[model samples]
Target: MPKNALGAAGPAVLALVLGLWGITREDSMWRDEAATWMAAGRSPAGLRHLLDHADVVHGCYYLLMHGLFEVFGPGLVTLRLPSVLATACAAAATAATGRRLAGPWAGLLAGTAFVLMPSTQRYAQEGRSYALVVAAVAVATWLLVTLAQDRPAARAATWRWVGYAGAMLVAALLNWFSLLALLAHAVTVLRAGRLGAGRLPRHWATAAAVVVTGALPLVLVSRAQARQVAWIPPLTWATAPAPLCLLGTGLLCGLLLRRRPGAPARTAAPAVSVVWAGLPLLAVPVLALLAASLIKPLYIDRYVLYANVGLGLLLGAALAVVVRSWRPFTALFLAASAALLPLHLGLRTPQSRVDDVLAPADAVARVSRAGDGVLFIPSLRRDTAEVSPQLFAGLDDVALVRSPADSGTLRGVEAAPARIREAMLAERRILVVGDPEDHPGGPGDATKRRVLAAFFVRCADAETRGRRVQVYERGTSCSSTPARRL
Candidate 1:
C-alpha cells in the first residue's frame, strides 16, 4: 500500500476492531435500533407508505438497511455491521483529510482519536444513519482539501467537484442536518490564502449548489414531517456544558497548532489552513444548530457527528507536534485507554442505552397470561412488543386499532379514548407497559390511566431499567396476586 493508503488503513482497521469488539451487545437491541429493524423489515410497499406519513428523514437509511436485511436476513450482526463499516470508512477519510493538511503521523493520530471518542464509538455500534453521514462528510471534506490544494486541469477538477457534490448529497439524504458541513467548508474556503484565491471560490459555490439542488426534495418532504422531532427538548443551560467543553478543547488544540517562531513558511501555511478548516468544521455546525435551537429546539449532538473528523484532525496534529516520538505517543495512548476502559466496557452492556426494548418484552412475557389485554400507556411503548412479537403473541393489544405496519406509522394509530376505555373494561385482566412514571399526557394515555385507577387494581408488577410492566385485575382487590420480578 502507498504511504497515504497505509495511514488511512491503520485507523480504519482500528475502528473496525473496536466497532466489532462487542457488536451484538450480548444480543440486546434498544428502541432506536428496534425502530431500524421494524422499518427495515417492512415490505417495500409498507416502507413506502411509512415514509409517506413519517420518518422520511430516515427513509434513505431505512431503504438501505431494508436491502441489506433482504440479502443477509435480520439479526444483530446484520443490523449493526453497516454502522461498523461506515465508521471504518469515516476513520479512513478523516486520516486522508489530516494527511492532506498535516503530516502522515498527524493523519494517523487523528483517525485514532476519532475512532476512540465516546460519541464516535457509541454511534459506530448503533444501527443508524449517523455513522454513514459522518463517513460522507469526511470524504467530502477530504475532496474539498484536494480541490483547494491542487490546481488540476479543469476536467479533473470538475470531476472532483462532482464527487464532492455527490458525497454531500448522500449525507443530506441520510440526514439533512449534515448539510451544515457545507457551511464549515465555506468557512474554510473564505479563510484560505493562496488556496482560496482565483476560481476555487466559484468552483466550491457551484459544487455546493449542486448538492443543495440534489437534496432539495428530501429537505422539503422532511420539513413536512418536522413534528417527528417534537420530542427534542428545548435548548437550556444544562445543554450548554457539552458544547462549551468541546469548544474549550478545540481552542486548546488550535493553540497547539499555532506556528512556532522558526517554523518554515511552507509548513506554516498548511498548519494555518488546517486550523482554519478544522476549527470551523469542529465548531460551526454545532454552534449553528444550538443557535437555531434557541428558536425551535432542533439541536441534538448526534446530528453533527461528522464534526468529530475535525476534532480528529486537530487533536492528531496537536499530538504529532507535542509528543515528538512514537514511544511517548504510545505511552499516552495506553494511559488514555486505561482511563476509558470502564466506559468502553460499559458501552457494550445491555444497560448502556436509555432503555432496552427487550427488557419490557421480558417483563410482559413474565406477567402476562393468555387472552390478557395489553395497553401501552403512551401507545409508543408498543415498540417493545414490536421488537419481540413472540413474547407478546399471547396477549391482546386491546388499545391498538391497527398494527404499525398496517397503519403506516411508527407506533400505530390507537383507538379513541372512549373505545380504549370500553375495550379495557371488557377485559378480565389487562397489562400496562410503559415508563415507570405514568405521565403520558396524551388523551388516550390519560383515559387509560383514569379507567385503570377507577375500576382495576394493580395485581402484579415488574419494574426494569427505564420500563415498567403492571398487571391490573378487573376487581378492586388483588389479595391473591403474587409479586413478580422481571
Candidate 2:
C-alpha cells in the first residue's frame, strides 16, 4: 500500500483488533447497555412507545440497533459490533483529516493516537452510541477540511459541502449533544473569514440550518424528557479539570511541535489552520457545557467524546515532530505498547464495569430454588436479571407488574407497594439484587424491604463488583413479631 493508504488503514486495523479482543467477554452489561438491549430488542412499535415515555435521546440509535439485533441476534458481540465498526470508521476518518490538514506522517500518528485512547477503546467494546457519534464527528470534520480547501466554483466542492451537511445531520440524530460541534464549525468559519464572503460559508450555513431544522422535533421531545440525565450533579471547580486537562494536553503538544528541527520548514499544516480545526472543536463544547451547567448540570466527559479527535490530531503532530528519528519513534511505540498491556488485560475482566451484575446474577442462579421470587431494589437494578435472563430464568420477579417487553419500558413496571408486599408474603424464598446497603428510599422498595424484614430471615449474602445478592427464607426469622401490612 502507498504510505497514505497505510496511514489510513493502520488505525482502523488496530481498532478492530483491539475492539475484538474483549468484545465477547463474560462481563455483564452495565445498566446503560442493558437499557440498549432492552430498547433495541423490542419491536419497532414497542421501541417507539418506550421512547415516548423515556430515553428519547437514544431513539434513533436504538432503532438502528433493533435492526442489527434482528439480523445478528443480541449476543454480546452482536450488541457491541456496531460500536466497534463505528470506532474503526472514526480511526480512518481521523487519519484522513490529518492527512488533509498536515501530511501522511501526521495522519498516521493521529489515527494511532485515536486507537490508543483509553476512552476510545472503552466505548468501542461496549454497546452504545458514543462511538457512532465520534465517527460522525470525525467524518464531518474531514468533510469540513475538504470544503475549506476547495474552490467554491468547483462542482466537487458543492458535493463535499452537501456530504458535510449530511454527516452533521447523522451526528445530531445519533446524539443531540453532538450538534455542539456546529458551534466549533462556526468558529472555524469566522476565523477563516468564510462567513458572508464566499459560497463555502453560505453553503455551510445552509447545511447547518438544515441539520438544526431536521433535529428540532427530536430536540423538543428529548428536552421534555430531560429527567433522563437528572443524575448529573451540578458543575463545580472539580468538574473543570477534565476539559482543562484535555485542552491543556492538546495545547502543550502543539507547543512541543515547535521544538522540532527546522520546525517551520517541515510543516504539514499551517499553524492557523491547525488552530482552527482543533482548538474550537475541543474547547467550544466544554465551555458551552460549562456555561450551561451553571443553570443545569449537563457536562459529562462522554458527551464530548468526539473532541478527543482534535486532541489526537494535535498530539499526533507533536509526536511526529519529537520522534523525527526512526529509532526514537520505534522506542516510543514499544514503550506505549508496554504501558497499555495492563489496561488491555483489565478491560477483559468482569470487574471493569461500575458493577459486574454477572457475578450477582450467577450467585442468584446458584442459590435460588425453582419458583423462588426475585426483587430488584431501586427497581432499575432489574437490569441485572434482564441482561442474564437465562441465569435468572426460573425465578419469578415477584414485584413485576409488567415485563419490559409488555410495558414498553427500559426497566419494566413495578407492582403497587401493596401488591408487592402481598406477593413477597406468598413466596417461600426470595432473591434480592441491588447496590450493597445503598437502597434509594422509594415506596415500592421500602414496602418490599419492610415485608422481607418482618417475615423473612437472611439465608445468604454475596457481594459482586458493585452489587449484592441476598437470599431470604420466609420461615427463618427469629422474631415472633407479625409482619405489618403496607
lDDT of each: 0.85, 0.80
Q: Which stretches in model 2 have alpha-carbon errors above 4 Å?
A: 194-197, 256-272, 325-330, 477-486
* Best by the lDDT measure: 1
Cα-lDDT of candidate 1: 0.85
Which 10 consecutive positions of candidate 1 have the poorest summed lDDT? 260-269
Candidate 1 lDDT, tens digit per residue, 382-455? 88898789999888899888999999988999999999999999998888898878674788888999999999
Give the alpha carbon lDDT tens digit for every residue of 302-417 in model 2: 88899988887777667666666554775877698679878877876667778765678888877777898999997888888777889998888999989877786767899899
RMSD of each: 2.4, 4.0
Which candidate number would show the highest TM-score if scored against the true structure?
1
lDDT of 2 at 34: 80
**Where in model 1 is the C-alpha error above 4 Å?**
1-3, 193-197, 261-272, 325-330
lDDT of 2: 0.80
For all candidates, the clash counts are 0, 0
